[model samples]
Target: MNTVGVRGYSLELRTRIVALVLGGASPGEAAKHFSVHVDTVKSYLKRHHQNTLHIVAKPTGRRRTVMALHEQQLLAQLETHQDATLQEHADMLETITGLKISYKTVDRVFRRYKITHKKNTGRQRTP
Candidate 1:
């Protein structure tokens, strides 16, 4: 059984597998023919059986902070307070929005926005 990428199967392939099961192909048969795990075929068939088959399954996770309602305000705060450390940024966000967040969250937001505030690590020339 081939499990190539992270999600294992592409959306188009998943849809096709589900369609095959619906068209009276046994899940195991479909799995062998497609070189996919039988369990994976069963999962697709389950969605088909439950009438919840989607060509593109809705993403299943928390939405990104960058897409939050307060994203613009957060970006502006980051821009205006360029020298603030990650902890400071988190505290500032808490103060302004009453939403306390971790320094890691601040770091992740900075990374997502391509904002760089890291101190230079190279040694300076002696005077």
Candidate 2:
């Protein structure tokens, strides 16, 4: 889901907003004090009444990854084949782990570990 500007409120903040409303403050007043939407304050009040005032856990967004399960094996393979390109590394990983993974995934893993895929070339002289 696209959540560019959307965000979840903290449990403490929600509870405070609800408390404000319960303590004779209007929903709009609570919203203004908390700098949140009036609808948010209303929702908090509703949740308080329903006794379901809790913080929602965020989605992890972790899909299946070949490298995550076989980091040691992939590291061993890389140690044995330092000159292998990204595609070659991906193919070798697939063959060893029987998990389908793309070269881009391999590149992402390398980047995450701060490992450079490109070889160092001598400095170019400016004419």
Candidate 3:
């Protein structure tokens, strides 16, 4: 049960485990031989049957709030009001698009587009 990388098991091993299970080897037997959990072996078999098994599983996390349609609008907002805070920009975007978004979400979307905005550190330059 060697991992392909630092994350999940290698695709070849998973396929071999599935084949063993399908070729009359019990899931428990495969699990013992492969040093993997019975549930893991069963999941590979089920996923293989359902055509959803891939080398890596789909990413699991909170989905982004802002999408591609909002990218141009956000860029336009930044160009028009370069001094606006992230929260203010989020509010403006929500009002225009009628979708709830947070300051962090706005920042993430901007970063995804490789757009950097001025950060307000509240430090005035000494003359």
Candidate 4:
């Protein structure tokens, strides 16, 4: 997920790499020509052979919850109704967004932001 130093190989370059390798060029020769690793060229060739190169950027993890869009509203609501129970907060969110929601979803949002309980006065994170 950290793509800091990773310069992704584009489709044009990948095709060229694969094509060079398939056209009587060694993987190493194609890699050197493209300034990429031999394994990268080999992987391109493998995907080409498997007819899977067209697949691009498939999602990697669980889809974000519907509650994601109402994060700020939930936080502000919690700020005023800190004593409210999770189910009450969930109902409040439902009313705010007109969406069917559960206490578990609210709890997940709270957990994601490290939202504190009633005991903690500095409950909200300092942005």
List the global CA lDDT of all models.
0.74, 0.77, 0.82, 0.78
Best by TM-score: 2
Residues forming the 10-long window of minimal summed lDDT in candidate 1: 118-127
Clashing pairs in 2: none
Candidate 1 vs candidate 2, lDDT winner: 2
Candidate 3 regions off by >4 Å? 1-15, 21-39, 42-63, 118-127
Local distance difference test, candidate 3: 0.82
**Each model's total of backbone clashes:** 0, 0, 0, 0
Candidate 3 weakest lDDT stretch, 10 residues: 118-127
Note each model's CA RMSD in angstroms.
5.6, 5.8, 6.2, 5.8
lDDT of 1 by residue, 33-101 (tens): 888898889988887778765644555678665447455666878778766677887888888888877
User: Taking the tens digit of each residue's C-alpha lDDT, what string does model 4 give over 1-127?
Assistant: 2231333567787888888888899999998888888887888889999997656665567866564568887889888987787899889988988876788888888988998555446765333
Candidate 2 vs candidate 3, lDDT winner:
3
Candidate 4 overall lDDT versus native: 0.78
User: 54, model 2: CA deviation in Å?
Assistant: 2.5
lDDT of 2 at 29: 91
Better of 1 and 2 by TM-score: 2
TM-scores, each model vs. reference: 0.57, 0.63, 0.53, 0.52
Candidate 3 clashes between residue pairs 3 or more apart in a chain or in different chains? none
Q: In angstroms, how far off is 101's CA in candidate 2?
A: 0.6
**Residue-level lDDT tens digits of model 2 in 62-125:** 8657546666666677789887888898899889888777888787777777776655555322
